[model samples]
Target: MALLVDELMTKQPRPLGRSLILCASALSVALVTGCTSDSGGPSASASSPGQQQKSPSNGSDLTDEKLGKQVEKTLDTAEVSDSDPLFVEAGLERVGDGFHSVPDLTRGHSYKLSVVCVGKGKISLSIAVKNPVRQTLDCDGVTFRQHLTSSAAAIKIDGDGMPGATGMVGWRLDKADK
Candidate 1:
């Protein structure tokens, strides 16, 4: 009986030890994930003592309304004549969320594209269907313009925000006459 008891005790330790290790690993993963995950929402604007608080691009706090207005103002600033055929698309998005505008463009045609953003961090702009043209724009409430000839049957404009970026992003794409 003593021999049987000793054998059972020895056999129990392996499974018991493995269960403990698995539990510990799961707990560690849960803790780490909880500590590092973002809530995907706007954070409160607060500053610690003696820390300089930076203002947003439009001389005001960032909001969906403000972002829309900024984009509208940017689109209006384009130099398109009133009678020219124009295609425009704009949006207000989170800083890290990407935005895109896909428009059917004539092949071998000329057009002017204007993009703008008001927020923190840099936005990556990519244009064209194949072999896309890419550029980075600083989110400083400034409009960027580019003129290009269409190489594909359609044009796609994408803006991606960099990691750990804050504030709102806005853009406008104006399809111009040939």
Candidate 2:
């Protein structure tokens, strides 16, 4: 049994510490945001590190300019500089299960995916590049931000497969400053 365990450990691709660190970081972020509940509503603490407190929008139309303003406010509150060029800034509206695919993304560049729900509904968001899954987030108040490292030609934003899921999901994709 010992030999078998050692062989299995040797066959692993990534160092175990990397996975542990990732899990720890995710847990810390979750704790900081106070999003430990599964109920669909506003989070107890919506402000992330360096983020300002803002009232949750109540089913308002999320136009391009409005979404841009929200993204800018988030960036400003998070202390993220606006010197970096935006790769994609678009709004997505869907009534059922669907995905938005973004193609021709620059390799080795970091990207931020910000999602905001425009109406009253529950949403679960995920990201994928070809076959590999990258990140998944489900939060209340229908807002969350995820940082991703791009390595593929395209990426897909999935907002589906959740039971009774329906809403207008607004998204903003920005490239991080190198």
What Cα-based lDDT does every candidate model obtain? Answer: 0.69, 0.58
For candidate 2, the TM-score is 0.44
Q: Could you tell me which 10 consecutive residues in candidate 1 have the lowest summed lDDT? A: 39-48
Q: Give me the candidate number with maximum lDDT.
A: 1
lDDT of 2: 0.58
Across 1-178, the per-residue lDDT of candidate 2 in tens digits comes to 9999999988855778788989999999989666554333565455456555554455443443364454345434234444545655555555353456564577878877777654334555667764555444442334577777777456767665256654445566777766
**In model 1, where do residues sit more than 4 Å from their true spots?**
1-62, 77-84, 129-131
Question: What is every candidate's alpha-carbon RMSD to the true fold?
Answer: 10.5, 23.9
